[model samples]
Target chain A: MKWSELFTSSVGKKWIMGLTGIFLVLFLIVHVGLNACIFAMDGGVMFNKAAHFMGSNAVPRILEIGLFAGILLHIVQGWSLELSNRAARKKGYAIPMGNKGSKWYSRSMGLLGTLLFLFLVMHIAHFWVPSRITGLDPVLIDGKEFHNLYGEMLQLFQGNLLVVILYVLGCFALAWHLLHGFQSAFRTLGLTNNRYLILVEGAGALFSILVPLVFALMPISMYMGWIK
Target chain B: MQHYNMNLTLKVWRQKNAADKGHFETYPVKNISSEMSFLEMIDVLNEQLIKEGKEPIAFDHDCREGICGMCSMYINGRPHGPWQHNTTCQLHMRAYQDGDTIVVEPWRANAFPVVKDLMVDRSAFDRIIQAGGYISVNTGNAVDANATPIEKDKADDAFAAAACIGCGACVAACKNSSAMLFVGAKVSHLALLPQGSPERKSRAVNMVAQMDKEGFGACTNTGACEAVCPKGISIENIARLNREYMMAGLTEDK
Candidate 1:
């Protein structure tokens, strides 16, 4: 069975969506936790130490691979589905209008997904790739050769108002994706009962809002010199 | 609390039959109650139409309850009109004003063809359902609901999936005219139960196949299905369907 033939199938595309979506959710958790370290360390020595450790760790490297796969699969599957849907609609030109009753997010997943993917590219280029490839100075924290990753991040944040705005917009796009994505992801994975669902939805909404809000604020805070 | 009669205007889609051309017909309805359900207000208007030597507009309805999902119409560009969860039949006249103009139309989807006026053929949904939705549980072999004693979590999940009224609101709400939410709800309903275990492999495949066969667009994972579903059916079902389908292929004894 060729991979393309398999993935192009209706069922195959769904698997790709779920697998990548769940992986991205996991990535979001790790990313959020790592970013939270900035608040604890106040964007200084402690933050730099943590960021250095993350960039140098084997686990982060492995997760980055998964992250790349998740991004690719998510985007490709979404676009493919959109294309297929468009083809089907074209075939049925004379069909009567059925019920129109979904929310803006559900219908716009592809567009939002595209925006999120674009943001991912910018994010990796600005942060992840730079942290990896650029041989920036190693900081001295408690007599150890710590990487000044946080300092480097602060440099990126400083006076780059356009970048800050783009990052903020990216967060907003990610939040919109998750607002619908989180609940739908639960439904996709067979967890759609009321007891857990209500709780899951609440958690999904909170996490979605909180995670992006916190990240988006970091750029603003850096620009304000609140965390130098 | 005093009651008063008020005049209203209606622009209703009218088709004599499936073969006839349809058009919006207007009528004046009087003495509407704020407490009356939205459907009851329509009943008043229809009665007037009948009395004025005109044919009453035909619409789909059953149960008059939110659960049956038989009542569906776009009121002023919104599915099921102003209220969020309630069906069009369950909507109250108080949601509108004395002189408000109401534009009522049938659910608009390529798969859901109009049978007449406001009653579209939702049988496309039926075909999707018929396509291997249930497990091979025979009628006589019915075990006690308590016998299986499914994990509380699983049972709750099944119940949530079961809440879908097949109302087609998700389809109406989707911009791409996708039926992912609707197909997802049915898949989730049976997939969570022990009764559905034996045939879970084929269930996802068949349902998705049937969905495509019926000319419904694929799920884009956009999250609109969950937003517009009156039952708030999750996109998780689509995810589950994906998982189930994958498991089926992997487990095939090839």
Candidate 2:
């Protein structure tokens, strides 16, 4: 096989999906952890400080490029896979097998991934744009200036019910996408041993739920004024 | 076991040929004994159709047991039937009750086009096998190759993979019509054996290329194929196949 077949072949495209998928999963951990700093209740001081560091740090700034590349490759390969898979089945079953064969979320990965992709656009536009591109409101903390991203989060969520609701829905989509993608990426890498698979499945299930729950709670907390 | 009977309404797909568009034709079959296998119940339906001067439903069934894998029927939206790890011939009527409506159809996939009623041409699977599903031998040493000591676990897994009957159930049950399970089984079955060491590099790559050439879809790791597999072929083989193909691609001898 030619080296190019690594991306062009079916299994090769899946390799792309799996490799990039696991990478993005790691990024989600960093992202949600950073966002979760809002519960510090120090009037957005901690979150702003952390956000400023992540935004300004040289290493992280460089890693951001790789993050975007991973996201783009995942989306492009996922879309191509969806199209080809659709073409493989020319006829439809009379009575569709709904969750009898596999989970509905597993079959609907393409749709869920698309949903997450759209949600990501909204999320990046609202926060990433201000903090990174357009600049956030400057707040002085501990004799240093930092971008008040938490202030932006509060401004967006507290008064606007729709934005909060949309954020919650976005997290919902992320949960479903992660539910299938977590174990799937491992399976795609041929992690077939039942012993290790059980652990990955358990950890994956917990991570998928907890990560999204934390992300959703940030908007809900700010909207409901749960945190100072 | 004291057995009863069922009068079922079967919605079977009927297509004249590969080019012919198919439709479901319902048939009421009475006095189907619960003791009879699913195929025998179908045999009753076919006999009735013959008496009524209608063309009997054409399906593929060789070994009346589960091993042949020739019996291909998508019963009630699942390949084979409702029973877990069972072929159509092994599916007994006892699972169904009287007045049940069972929908039967040919395997739906672009690669396995409908050849006739309830029978899709599965020659695509054959072509995939012909690609690299074998290992070349020196032809003088059957005993020497057989004596190679394989680890118990690897041997068991390979035997399990080798149990695949090539029924195309994996493809039929897959939403994508992906044959990864089928190809994976073939690849793992040979790759596990020391006798198959010679073609290890080429088997996975060549077979996968042929599988693509056959127009089968890519696997999405849904586990649907494993769920409906009559042989209970594990999706682990697919993971192994993925590993094998990648290793082969990266280390191919140019």
Candidate 3:
């Protein structure tokens, strides 16, 4: 089938949106859980070892590649869907206010997702690629020396207050993106019941908020000099 | 209630016939009351237009109670103005200012061609509904409502789906101009009920096929239709429709 035909199909787009969305949701949990390990440890050798483990592991390498693919697919599919919608309507009309009934986040997904994409680029350029490629020493944990990825990350976070602020702002954007996205994904995938919708939307909000809040805090703490 | 004297300009669309080129003609309506519905204000204006021996601006309206779904227009760029759940007929003159220039036009869509002035042929929706809304009921004296002991959940879902007034607002508000929500509502009503069960498989299959047959775009779950629907029909109904279609597709394979 032609590319346009696939993107414009109801069944096809739903699967694309759902499959990519579910993958990103899983990625969020794993990414946050690994970062949360930083909070559990005293900010020195122990955290460094954990970070080194996550950064250097074979499985983590595969997961990172998969996560990148997921983000790309999600973005492309979402943009295509948005474009078709715009093309369908010939004229514009006022969206009723307040009780117009859609959540504000629902209306602004495309905007927030665009901002998040920029943030993602900055995130990778600052941390993911440079740390993986450049040579770095490991902080020795209990006489064992490994790549000191955690210490490098801390140094990067502390050295730039702007990075800290941007990371927090990015987290806020992600939170808003996921607030509507999570339940909307369920609706797209055909998993809606009123009882389940209320539950899913509620749980989705908590999960979305919690992931970004926890991940963004690591940079925040380092910038504040809370951990040295 | 005191009737307040005021003058306001209306940019009304005028067309002599379907092939006739249309243009906006302004008219000044004076002495409007807050108690009058928006359409009543239009009536007052049309009454004056007729008195002057000019062609009266034509528009659609019925069941001023907001249920008939005949009153579809984009009032000041809104599908149904700024108020939620309001049809143009239900919108009160109090919602506007004395000096406001209210621009009115027919609901614009390829499927909905303008008939004349503000009235457009919404027969596209009727064609979609007729495509699959009928179920074979043996020639009938009315059956007892209690004959079918439908689960409360299913009954509620069916009632919600039945609430769709065949309003073209969903198509009007949709960015893709998708009729999925409208078709989904019909499919959902049947899929959720015992009376509809006998034809459940064919109903979804046929309704969706007809929805596509009409020049409607596909659903992308942008939720614009749900947001603007006066009835507040959730897009969840569309999701349910998807599930039913999937199951029907699988069942037909056997």
Candidate 4:
């Protein structure tokens, strides 16, 4: 098949989904790792240091461009696939068998992904845009100036119940999305060996739950005054 | 099996042609013996319609024993009807209770436009098969069966994959109307044997290319295809197809 056809074809769209999906999974690991620094509970010193390094580093900055491109490609490809799939089934069954044919989450990827996209927009507005563009309040760590993103997170989460709720809900959607997508991405990439497939599924299940739980906990912990 | 008689009201789809607007036409079928196959019951209905100077409902069926895979009908929102692991032709009237109202319709998919009534053009499946569904070998006397040793388990797996009858049930049953299960069966069947190794990579790539060109939807691993498959073909073949495609993409020369 030609390179152009690869993107145009249904199976090729799937390959794109799987590739970008796995890339985003890797990004989540780094993101969660950075966010987990708040557990130190030291007035954002360690957290701010890590955040500043990630924001300023040249390698991470270059990869950030690719990450945005990947996200855009994933969204475009996903919505196109969803729309075409819907169009393929012009009529629906009168007696709809919802869960009998497939798992709810597997069929609901489009909805979950849209929710995640909205959450990402809000997330970027809350921190990424302010810190990277308009800039944020700086704090001195080790006699050097850095953006106090941890302080920003604390201020954002402590008093705003609605934002906290939205963050947690965003994590909720993320968990469900990953529950199906984690293993599905690998399966699309042809990881079909029985033994390793089982292991991948087990690990995917754990990752889906744990990563989102930690993300949800960050805002919840801040709102409850546990992280102060 | 003991035979029993029953009455049924069937709401069957009726389309004059590819461009005609189809609608359900209800017909009463009485004294249907429990031992009669579903197609045979339809045969009775057609006979009655013809006697009444009405156009009989058009449906596709051949090799009434179910091996031909020519029978394609959606009964109560399921491909090949409600019975498990059986084609519509193999389905007996015994599965239905007396005075049942069964709704029968043609397979719905953009790629498979309805020809008339319960018959849809399944040439897309044929095109996919034509893309690379064969192994090229020099014409000669058949080689000894034992010349190339194949593992027992591998042979069994290959046989299972080879059981796909080119039926479009998997596509009809899929929510996305995806043909991955069908394509997977073909890919896995050939990829398992030594005779198919030479063109394995291109076969996977070209067949998938044709499947997409046919306008089938993407697979979401619903397992509906496996459930409705008369041959009980597993979704594991889909996984193998995915593996084969990815490997081909990686190894193929630019």
Lowest lDDT sum, 10 consecutive residues, model 3 chain A, at: A92-101
Q: Can you rank all candidates by lDDT, best first?
A: 2, 4, 3, 1
Candidate 1 Cα errors over 4 Å, as ranges: A1-15, A32-63, A82-108, A128-151, A192-195, B1-4, B14-27, B30-58, B61-71, B82-96, B133-167, B174-197, B218-254
Off by over 4 Å in 4: A91-97, A140-144, B1-5
Clashing pairs in 2: none
Error of 3 at A41 (Å): 4.7
Error of 4 at B21 (Å): 1.2
Ranking by TM-score: 2, 4, 3, 1
Displacement of residue A93 (Cα, Å) in model 2 is: 0.8
Q: Against the true two-chain complex, what DockQ does each candidate achieve? A: 0.20, 0.75, 0.24, 0.50
Displacement of the residue A117 alpha carbon in candidate 4, Å: 1.1
The clash numbers for all candidates, in the given order, read: 28, 0, 2, 0
Please provide, for model 1 over B12-128, each residue's C-alpha lDDT reduced to its tens digit, 9 standing for 90 to 100: 888777777777778778888888887888888778778888777778888887789999887877778767666898888878778988888877777887788888888988888
Error of 4 at B121 (Å): 1.1
Error of 4 at B93 (Å): 3.3
Work out the TM-score per prediction: 0.71, 0.97, 0.84, 0.93
Write model 2 residue lDDT over A88-163, tens digit each, in one string: 9978899776677788899999999999899889889998888888887788898888888888888888979999
Supply the DockQ value of model 2: 0.75
- lDDT computed for candidate 2: 0.89
Q: Taking the tens digit of each residue's C-alpha lDDT, what string does model 4 give over A134-186?
A: 99998998899989898899899998999999999999999999999998887
Query: What is the CAPRI rating of model 3's predicted complex?
Result: acceptable
